[model samples]
Target chain A: MSQPDPLADFFAADAAPAVDRGFRMAVMEQVARRRLRVELALRSLATLLLFVGVALISPVLQRFAQLLGQDLSQVLLVMLAAGLVAYLGHFWLTRKPVLRLPHLRFF
Target chain B: MSTPPTDAALVAAARSGSDAAFARIVDRYQGPIRTFLRRLGPYTSDADDLAQETFLTGWTELRGLREPARLKSWLFSIAWRKAKGEARTMARNRQRDHDWQEIRPDCETPETERAIALHQALAQLPPDQRAAVSLCLGDGWTHADAAGVLDMPLGTVKSHVLRGRTRLVEILGVDS
Candidate 1:
């Protein structure tokens, strides 16, 4: 006897819809372009930040150290610590939320 | 003859910057993503955009996936979240707030009307419940796989599937 499958209609609706090849190509092209853009932007930003920090911030730090009669090395160390904190804060604020991925043994 | 590489192997290759491997992965999954999106909405452009966005996000984050073999579930999770976010924006613009917009079935033939009704009934379900039903009943995924994709507990996925099925029967005028 052929058994009745009641949920067959629901399953029938799950057929793979027609999607053109251009869709896949568009996705890959965008991903590649984004990877390059992000890499270049990050490189440019880091270079700019490093240049400004060293050229401008160092002289300002030297002035502050001399005026406060503090050791220049100690002032520089504090500035480095502040920079580290800023970098971390930026990362925490900008990081994309990660996906929740876990293996399913049942699959 | 060589056996096909597992998803994990392909993922590892893709992570190493192998575009070919990533392309293979895309070739394997594009249909499911597209079909899932199509079932979720009537607008072809919306489905197409979301499908592409889903893969782009997948490629961006594939390196960080905990389990490579879980690629299908992971991709579905990303798609699910993207679809939900887009739905929120659309609903906001329209000043309406239904999670799943019940699309009136528009098939021409009688044979297809029941199937379209099933799709509409499926869409009428709450988003999470519809996802559970789609992944489990529609796609024939195991409860565990559906749970993984939906990021819900196993029991919850099972419950959603059961309840979703009952609701579909009621909406489609089918006996339990």
Candidate 2:
């Protein structure tokens, strides 16, 4: 006859809980949120690059506009300011407080 | 009717960014992963969070997994690491606060009472020995397979299982 082992019996009888759809849904939701964050980050990087490219070429464009009797610096300044505000606002609304830079850190 | 795809096939599809394939993988492995974490000691309260982190890490690092055939052991390895990290973090927190306490598992019934006794006995063991017992004796994993998951040597795993079981039997025997 087999020996009675309570330890083995205890382990053997420990049934796993039934499959929970809620758990899967929670995980999938996290995966979707992560994908969205990556997409937003990539789009933000592209926008920043576009802004830098525009700023780099602005001096040349301003010279052309001066010859045409017009000033372009004010408009470029306004566009740059708007982009900075939008970027800061997005960062403020979405990112965790810990992710903020030291200057902007809010504990 | 079609047979379900194997874990390797699911892993390949997941690495290709198929959400459906990844969900299938989560559904397939979540039970075992969660159960293992619950048995892993002290952090049973964080079992769900730990399991979610394991799957998330698995998803992010799926492409880095060299052998698709070893997905089960790989996921278990991730679970073990996550549990260990959580334990360290909790230990640090516990030290900071003299009043720290682990969140107790629900124990309203006779069965749960017995489970609580087992958990208490298991907690008395060193962490590695507890894990060895949980993997080998509790989950019925082979010693070699458990060693692979734990990254311990075969002989060490065997020694841990033997000693852990003996200690557990002594503890539970006294309790009963």
Ten contiguous residues minimizing lDDT sum, candidate 1 chain B: B93-102
The digit string of per-residue lDDT tens for model 1 on B32-151 reads 887777666545568778988998889888867999998998999898888888877655544222323344445466545665666667667877887888787777899998887778
Error of 1 at B29 (Å): 1.2
Q: Relative to the true structure, how large is the alpha-carbon lDDT of every model?
A: 0.75, 0.78
In terms of docking quality, how is candidate 2 classified? incorrect
Over 4 Å off, model 2: A1-5, A13-15, A54-107, B92-110, B174-176
RMSD of each: 12.2, 9.5
Candidate 1 docking band:
incorrect
Q: Quickly count the clashes in candidate 2.
A: 0
Q: Look at candidate 1 and tell me the lDDT of residue B27.
A: 78
Provide TM-scores for the models: 0.68, 0.73
Model 1, range A1-107, lDDT digits (tens) per residue? 97665777656755664455676688889888877777777777777988988897898877877787657668778999998788777768878333332321110
After superposing all C-alphas onto the true structure, candidate 1 shows an RMSD in angstroms of 12.2
Residue B57, candidate 2: C-alpha displacement in angstroms: 0.9
